[model samples]
Target: MSNRLKTGLILLTIAFLLGCILVQMFTQTLKSEITTLPDGYHNVLIRVPTTFEFCGEQVPLYDEEVKESFDKELYINVFRHSSTSLIIKRSEKFFPIIEQILREEEVPEDMKYIAVIESGLENVRSFAGADGYWQFMEETAKEFDLEISKEVDERFHIEKSTRAACKYLKRSYKKFGNWTLVAASYNRGMGGMNAALRNQNAISYYDVALNNETARYIYRALAFKEIMQHPEKYGFVIPKELRYPPVKYRKIPLDTTINDISALAVKYGMSYKTLKYHNPWLLMNKLTFDKKDLKNKKEYILLVPQNPPMPHSNVLAQESLQMQKMLDSILHEEDTVIDIQDVK
Candidate 1:
């Protein structure tokens, strides 16, 4: 190549490299500025209560480390506005049922916050294979006498799962003799919690060092309890009318297998989508009973809606109007009819 051409190509390559470096430098500076907090808002204020209790056991807020841990969790939860607000709204719908069950099982009502923390009061599955509102693993769920079959998983059944959780909590209380430890044990398995206690020679949960997830678990539950109990104090003010109301439904008991759930839903004047919402435990479109279930005469309870939600779409509204028209036409035709014997 000619010297002039070679020189021009070399200069172009150098300019390109310099331009790339400059762009990267500018991007890094922009990121650093974007992440910096605005002036005078450097630190957040989260007020930790002077005294706190979990299941009526006093939180050792006097201990500096425990106080700091509690403060951290409170800070995290207080700032989680959207999640915290939705939880507060859902609490209205679920708490009544949970509280009654807890009372019947003689478990502490405060323990309900564990469910809030575990699944945000929703039936959700974890990456670790824990499922349902209570976050019970398949093995533990079965051990607690919860049914986990292909056709049905009772862990998603709110009433039954809450009962199962209470049973586990009572058993844990028996083991630890302390609700706080039981809460800790719920995160770290009972075996893991025992091992941690033995290895650290620690009597209380606050004294023992734990894995990050387990360490934060109890504090998260406590934070939720504190925030939910006094939501307005934390800047959450969900209106009374905005809260989710408890679902209204009637239970139908059946021993026979349902070969076509869609047809059954149609028979009840509901959509398959509506049926699934009330009976989330019914995992598939159709539910079947084994020969053993038939022989034992096992009865499965299905929740059919007494008051289904109002139609939100134009199509659904039209369908509802048509159904009402059909009903009215039948009643009108009956009123106009005369018996053959009366005519004669």
Candidate 2:
């Protein structure tokens, strides 16, 4: 055989060998990227029956419009995994207090989910000067009987803000004569919702065309209700033990000025940060004596931590339990429950 022919054949052989090796490497890497699930990883979908009642009007979920809106929220929330998961996690920490307040106020139980959509259950301050889980502006907060001032903004107080929200919802219901409209009015002001109703000549919140946020508001609430009610259907697998536990506290009525909050916290066996964590409404490091209160004689309520849970105690506990279960099930290791002793 000629040397040229021999070289060409050898070169083709080398190229073929290189291509095969590269293909094998790529396949192995892809396989590793797709993590293998252990036995029992797949969970059965749990379906919970849901029916809507708005302003004493029973709305059937099977109705095409209702189903469409419900489906829209369900699909969106299910696919938006991160936000939904966070909402689920936070609900454990905040929902009990919110639910209790809602019950006391005689507000609809479903309305608790409104806070989830409003601030994801965080004490967040909006750029537009709205603050708290319920997102109350200064004037609005004061109008709803929430104290908003330089030293204190009770809008950050979960209980106070929720009560304010209930009042607002009640007022909205009175104006619109519909719970759906009341919910929508939370996004679009009562005046705006009413104006939209008049302009479109539609009485129903579902029928009315609205601005972008208002349009999606009710659907978001419905979606949250569906996903939260049936987490497994939406691919969420949070164990019962993985849910956040409620924090305990005692209320202290303060009639006098606190010169040093740090000292006050230390006196109560807590750090300054801990005091602030529980009482986010306390905006200042030092509490000033209100001269007007002395003449008028009003008392300030301070939430003193009796035995507050450790920071991120609920989240850490949940994550640890989940990881332990996964580790045991996947690795064929013995299931061991780690005792999370209280840190606070």
Candidate 3:
């Protein structure tokens, strides 16, 4: 081969190797950039049944706009896995009680989901200073006969607060003449909703354009209802045991002052913490009652844990007593004596 041709070939080989190295480096840089990019939000598609009735109103879940809104909520809630999971778990403990009250009040059972949207089924204080599972403000709670005080806040009391919510919804329904408006009024006060209705001259909640929070309120409620009703559809598979069970207790009437809750707890064979666990409405270590006043009789209701014999309590108690007697007999036997000091 000619020297010039060999030299050209050698130069070509060097260029090819350099080009290959450059390409490899560029590919890695591109891969890293792709990996580092923030994850894109994926829109989840939820298949809701055609139409669901809430409080005698037909909500078209399958309608295009309704489905889109529902899908948006499903995606948002599903991606917010932690919050949704906790809500689901807490619902197990709270829903039964709320359901019973709603049934008694003749309110729609679906209205129970309203609590989930309001506070995620938690007794949380809002940035606006609203408190409790129902998120009742001081005035509203008082208006509903919920005791809101430093010493006693019944907003934290699930049963009382739920009953208060029922009253509010019923009144809202009477005023608005529709369930959707009633639900929306929960977010925007009855006055606010009425004002909106007058300003917009619209009877329907959907027609009224509202501020951001109030606008999203009804949609969030319906979304919560959708996801919670079929949690499996949202990739939430909580074990039955992971769900909290409703605690059982007997309501004992105690007109007298409870000076020592710890001693009271011990008398019931439970820890003081346990007593408070079941009755969180008890604000202080000691309950004060006006002994002289007749009205004080209704002031106190002590919830004592029903120590109903466990399924195995009888067997275990009997075995423990037998074992104690055997040990006592052995220790107190006069025939059993030992030398004090053998070495001496």
Candidate 4:
């Protein structure tokens, strides 16, 4: 090659390298703050907002360390597309019920997101024996009026579990008066949180030196709230109809002992599996009731689904809606007795 040609090639390569360096520098500068939404839709990157809050409590985003921690959390969730997408979809079905309960109890709407972080809004039993969407243990569940006998475990009951959670949140708020700390207290017990505050000599949750799980708790809840409210911005593109719609069920008043739940299921024109799916609070194969029990508890709410439940689904939810609409017989009247052999 000629010397002149070699020099020209080197100059071109240098220009290209400089351009790449400048681009990388510009992108790094933009990572901390988004002055405007970036162009593009699918597979685009996003940064955490400069200003953030939880239930109206301001995050100290101005501090570099705090901002970086916020950045880490947002990235962890926003990039976890599949799981986060499931959460976005599940929220549509569950949040309506949770929000209504929170509103009725005068709790902040943000508390609904805690359920998302707790069990992904599902009836999950934790390794520690914490069960349901709110993750309450046996004592705690009973302490909050959740019936957890051999026949019933209200921890798996959605509305009842949420009401119990609201009761816990209210008690926490009475002690801390800060919703964020109250959120942290859900993971770090109320006493643990109080001790941390005293030991660290800090008034705010941000100031406390906490264990990894407790420290990450509020941030995870905030991240869930942020992505859920602004799904598109976080690159979650679930359609409105594609999100899981709220479950529908017919409420049956059960006053007598259910000697055999399988028979009870058949009497309702539902499979045994379908019966338990809807009435997760029904803990046993047989529910024994004494006549005396009815004096104080006049009736129990048996949630028999109008159609089978679609847990963690959008397409199945739509299909279930169609099933509910089909012309069908009321296979047995409410008073019909199920055969004992069906139970056997």
Candidate 5:
């Protein structure tokens, strides 16, 4: 072989060996750094408070069984960091809306926490066919006077569903005569709770021996109330700005049927997705009323952006420009150097 060719081959082999060594060093360094945590940064046991209350009714923490139940729930929620963190973040957005409705309905202000435990302040449908933030079943939702049709389910409507929940709570309060029983009955159903009380001869919820879910129901709510109220004590240190912000919107009240919801969104200078985000109760592409609904002149409210959205095309164009700028910056940057000695 020529001297020139031999020299090139040796140089290439040396470069490959050096690259492998550098990669090995980098991997080991990364592993060491990640495995070592700073002092005092570790999971710790949550301390149970001596006293607790729900909606002004005191929890019987003095009872050993009840105290253990409370401790179990607190440990579960405190250690379930991801779920609890999101719940705290979302509470900032939704709690104000719920608190107002509860106050206006004369329900205890602490009743607002029920929604947090119910749906995590989300518009989610449960596996047992319960729907929305309040997790109302179809029949119960209708009984509470929330409209449930093909194109719209008012249970998914935040403001309307909250009012409906208030109605149920008020009625339950009249039946049970206390906010604590009313909260319990929300989980165990009014009729079921009544039967349980009659059979057990128990007046207080604490005195009843019920099914597992119904048993843990009040304690779970209480646990969430404590952690959410004093999150920092449980080691949740989310910043105020990191919490979800409340959305602002203007309501468009209409009794007329809409043939094409997408067209309506375009007319309002927004996309159909944006419209649906604001009004999740709109379940279909088009909305129509039957003769009965038309005769009754049923009204529906559609939430539109407070500051109208830019046209969909404009938004796409802006996003495209931003993406292109990012790519350009990455492509045009100077080469990054990783010194082998710096790896450790």
Candidate 6:
């Protein structure tokens, strides 16, 4: 090989090696830096306060079994950093809407935490066919006057479902005359809780022995409330901008059936995905009305994002510019020192 070619090859190989070493050092340095504990942090010993309450009723934290159950929920949630962080973040966005409904219905404000446990503030369907943030079964949702059909399921609509939940909770409160039992009744059906109370000859939820899942229901809700009320104490540290903000939207009424939700979205100057993000209640591409619905003049609400995500073209352009800037910085860093010995 010519001398010039040999020299170029040597520099190229040395530069590649230097880049690898520098990248590794940078990565290791970052790894060693103090960072948020994403997997939960705890000391070897932990103590929980003896007193706790759900709604206006007190938890039997003084009892050993109750303490054990409360501890399990509290520690498990604290250590589940990522999942709990999402709950912490989403509550800020959704809790205000729910709180308002609770006030209107005269339901205790703490009842809003039930949604956190039901679906983690998400529009999710359960394996058992329960849907929405409130996780209402089809029959229960319909009973509470929430529309659930193939084209639409209002159980997925945050505001609508919360109102439905409040309706159900108010009915439950009337039956039990205690908000605590009403909260439990939401998990184990009102009938089931009544049966447990009757069978055990106990008047309150604490005195009745129930299945594990139902038993843990109130405790989990309580755990989430504690964390939400005091997130810093539980180790969640969300920054102002990093926190998910409440969504603002325009709710357009739909008296007539929409042949296709996607086409409707285009009319509103948004993509179908953006439409779905704002209106999760829309389960299908089309919204059709039968004679019964048309005659009844059924009304559905379609939410359009007020601040739709940056248009697709803009997002791509911004991403490209960011990539170019990063590439330029890396090239500049390499330009300043191609000598391998200088890196050391």
Candidate 5 clash pair list: none
For model 3, residues 1-344, the per-residue Cα lDDT tens digits are: 99999999999999999999999999999999876745533334566667766667877664587667656776788879889989999988899999999999988888887899888988788998898889999899999999865556888888999999999999988987888889888988899999999999988776788998888777777778878888877777888799876767888776667788878877777777777776777777787666464464556567777863333544788999999999999988877755568435
Model 3 lDDT, full chain set: 0.81
Error of 6 at 42 (Å): 7.0
Residue 178 lDDT in candidate 5: 80
- Score candidate 5 by TM-score against the native: 0.79
Which regions of candidate 4 are displaced past 4 Å? 1-41, 307-344
Residues 1-344 of candidate 6 have per-residue lDDT tens digits of: 99999999999999999999999999888887755344646432335667877887888887898888888998998888899989888887898899998898888999988999999998888999998999999998899889877778899988889999998998988899998899999999999999999989999887789999999998898888788887777667777578788888787888887788887877777778888888888889998888998999988877777877755855787999999999889878956658878767
Candidate 2, 1-344: lDDT as tens digits: 99999999999999999999999999999998676667645433433246765435565677676667667777777777777887898888898899999889888888987898889899998999999999988898999999877788899999889999999999998887778888889888989999999999999887887887888888788778777877877788787677776677787888877888878887776778889988899998888777887777777777876675444644787899999998778766434544468332
- Stretches > 4 Å off in candidate 5: 1-45, 290-295, 308-313, 317-344
Candidate 1 versus the native: TM-score? Answer: 0.78
Q: Relative to the unseen true structure, what is the Cα RMSD of model 6?
A: 16.9
lDDT of 5 by residue, 145-181 (tens): 9989888899999899999999999999999998888
- Candidate 6 structure lDDT: 0.85
Cα displacement (angstroms), candidate 4, residue 302, comes to 1.1
Candidate 3 similarity to native, TM-score: 0.75
Deviation in Å, model 2, residue 87 alpha carbon: 1.7
- Pull out the clashing pairs in model 1: none
Q: Pick the candidate with the highest TM-score.
A: 5
Colliding pairs, model 6:
none
Q: After superposition, how far is residue 40 of candidate 1 from its true place, in Å?
A: 21
Query: Lowest-scoring 10 consecutive residues by lDDT in candidate 6?
Result: 37-46
Against the true structure, what is each candidate's TM-score? Answer: 0.78, 0.75, 0.75, 0.76, 0.79, 0.77
Error of 4 at 280 (Å): 1.2
RMSD list, candidates in order: 12.0, 13.7, 6.9, 12.4, 15.7, 16.9
